[model samples]
Target: MSEMQSTRRGRPGYDQQGILAVAVAAFNEHGYDATSIGMLAERLGLSKSAIYHHFGSKDQILDLALDAALSGLEAVVDDPLPASAVEASAVARLEHVLRGAVHVLIAQLPAVTLLLRVRGNTEVERRALTRRRAFDRRITALVSEAQAEGALRADMDASVVARLTFGMINSIVEWYRPGGREGADRLADDVVAIALDGLRRR
Candidate 1:
């Protein structure tokens, strides 16, 4: 359906996307398991049936929100490097992926935050976790290649490095505030620097 028609069909000024955003926020605030369709309806000032009109169920909303995050991260991992970076070393490509991840995290903060909190309780959460592990494997391979090329430290296990790097990136959701002291670009740069280059002086 056209955007106009979809908007008119739903509550005024609220369509599926708007409703999904509010639902994500609610899920993040109260644990997803604790949240319900009734709560989302109340938060949106609409009846439960109105919510059902847009979504099949609360699980459907969770599925969409998780996909928002997973797709962003998957894109970062799957996308080919730019022409300049295509010939770059594995470490450089790794850095590029890391920067991209930081941007995705910042841009899709709510979805990504919701994703990180998932514990594989339901089929939706399990599917997200599975995709997340695949993403991690890609990063681990890149880290291994970089180490083989003598760019990154060899002492650490590649999978461990990958997890730790993402651990730092994932931690941003707890503290990052959009339009605050730092912007996404700066945060990306800082994340790459700290993850690649050690905090101790060279």
Candidate 2:
């Protein structure tokens, strides 16, 4: 099967990973409902049958793309912040994770955009949203911990803080384009400053 899929239209042969990236970009640009298999084939410079040969349906591509997108956030959620950078402080850890989330959004711009835009209309979309909410819960716990430690303000509810913080980071998909005047690290720095400054205890 691999040998048979060596080349299609002088481009690729069953390159699901590469095809997934293109599909994600198209989905992000035109919306998942608007992007068609025919459009995907044209974007990938392959035939519709070639795309169908690898993916049974367009939803499969969406599933894979959502997988690609959510994995980055999940990886960040699962990671243990190094003691050197965070100094075992819940607030520091929260800041570190928030900053990292921006970098992930920048790095996986297209897929993350799709992840943010999911409407839960399908099983795949619902599953992706569930994973996102799970990540949100994790951040909320961190916010709660930070407040308990007197690191963050407790005037507002922790869940509200978490929601607003993520609201800012998630909104990046709407206006962020690659090759911007600022790098991801710089954007992370600026975003962290703005997010943490407002949340920090006076």
Candidate No. with top TM-score: 1
TM-score, model 2 to reference:
0.87
lDDT of 2 by residue, 37-118 (tens): 9999887778999888879999999998888778888788677777566457899888778888998999988888888889
TM-score of each: 0.93, 0.87
Clashing pairs in 2: none
Cα displacement (angstroms), candidate 2, residue 118, comes to 0.7
- Residue 36 lDDT in candidate 1: 94
Cα lDDT of model 1 by residue, 1-202, tens digit: 5542345564465788888899999999999989999999888888999889989999999999999999999999887788877788999889889999999999999999999999999999999999999999999999999999999999999999999999999999999998989998999999998998878896
> lDDT of model 1 at residue 195?
90
Q: For residue 50, what is the lDDT in candidate 2?
A: 82
Point out the worst 10-residue segment of candidate 1 by lDDT.
2-11
lDDT of each: 0.92, 0.85
Residue 89 alpha-carbon offset, candidate 1, angstroms: 1.5
